[model samples]
Target: MCVQAISNPRSEDDQEKAWQAVCPLVNQLRNYYEFSIALEAVVVDLLSVLCSDEMTSRQHLEMQQSLFKQFAEILDFTLKFDDLKMTNPAIQNDFSYYRRTLSRMRMAGGDDIDKDLDVNNDMANRMSLFYAHATPMLRMLSDNTTKFVSQNKDLPVENTTDCLSTMACICRVMIENPNYRSKFSSEETVLFCLRVMVGAIILYDHVHPVGAFAKSSGINIKSSIKVLRDEHPGKVEGLLNALR
Candidate 1:
């Protein structure tokens, strides 16, 4: 039965049916890290199916948002552990799969990867619901950085690095995609976006390359730090060093 669902999803209806059939199994197994690595990949691939551009309806995008929300919970489950060792290779592979699928989605649904995004539009509000749910997952990255550092335990620095790399890749896609950028003009979204970027910088190496996208993200992070100069100068400076 599971094989039928996973083997040949034929249409939008078929994909949705496959997801419905497979999703509950993913949720039930996600808690067992050692046993669920392959399950995670299969589930994330199903997510890519749901997010495909052929759906082409506002309602389909809403379904995509819900799917991402579910993925975020799975990520949270993966990170709920106290240390990174047990999670290392499985989590790394999961994130790598995520990067590939999201990049495909971005290119399929996005604009020129090298262009600057228009700041005037709301980006179909794909981001409107996504960031709200994804924020907690990003925060888990931030918290893990500090926790690992403070413990003086073996820091799986690469875990944070992989996440920032995945995020930077996604950020580049967003900044380059006009629809995605339109959502950033809202003050709340703008600030929240900078907070996550800056927090990652405080934790790891530079994940983005020389490009308009990276430059823009850098500018926003610097500006946000300046605004909070009086409130958290030390952490702000830490972010600056991370950027450098």
Candidate 2:
């Protein structure tokens, strides 16, 4: 089902229909009680198709919008803020939801995030255009995930670790997309991306102990942070310190 639908969303109607079919599954998958690496991999692989470099500019833009809209559906399905998850003694199920969602978003925004090879001629423009469609959900999801992680201590290390990794990807995309770079200074997207990066670094260090954020995220978050440091050093001081 995912393979056929994501194979090529060439039209708006097809995109919407494709999301309608899968959004429920995505919602159900988000709140898994146990962290199954297999199911997570499957979700990542399917969403990667929409966010991959293997599409036309038009298709990319449509697919990004469709993906986020589907995310909003999942958000609507369950935005539980109560202590039910904590008291119920099922933090894994509750916390894994945010971890999974952020992981998926990071993967989706990833094509142009860190890979220099992904950019060629018209590719930068395509990513920037896709960003315009992608930023709202990206901003919302990252912020919510960060907030949730900060509040919950017993959640698995994977929840916080995955959140940081994904945020790094998002920051990388914001910095690299030249078409949208002009908006970097004043855009909420830029501010949120930086904040998320800082949070990710702190979380990574706390969770992994010896694991370095720069080496762990590899190119995606590192290059993205480099772009910010080169362009706006003062604004990114928090992110810089967190990396160190």
Candidate achieving the largest lDDT:
2
lDDT of each: 0.39, 0.43
TM-scores of all candidate predictions against the true structure: 0.26, 0.32
State the lDDT of candidate 1 residue by residue for 1-244, as single tens digits: 0111144556868755754554443332233322343444444354344434455323443556665445444443333331232223343333333334335545776845314332111331332232223233334344544444444335343433444444334433454457887878664443334344444443343322332135543334444344445334543443334334
Tens-place lDDT digits, model 2, residues 143-226 = 444454455455554544543455455556766778766776665556555554554454455445355344554335557557
Model 2, which residues run further than 4 Å from truth?
A: 1-156, 182-188, 214-221
- The collision pairs in model 1 are 123-179
What clash count goes with each model? 1, 0
What TM-score does candidate 2 reach? 0.32
Candidate 1 has a TM-score of 0.26
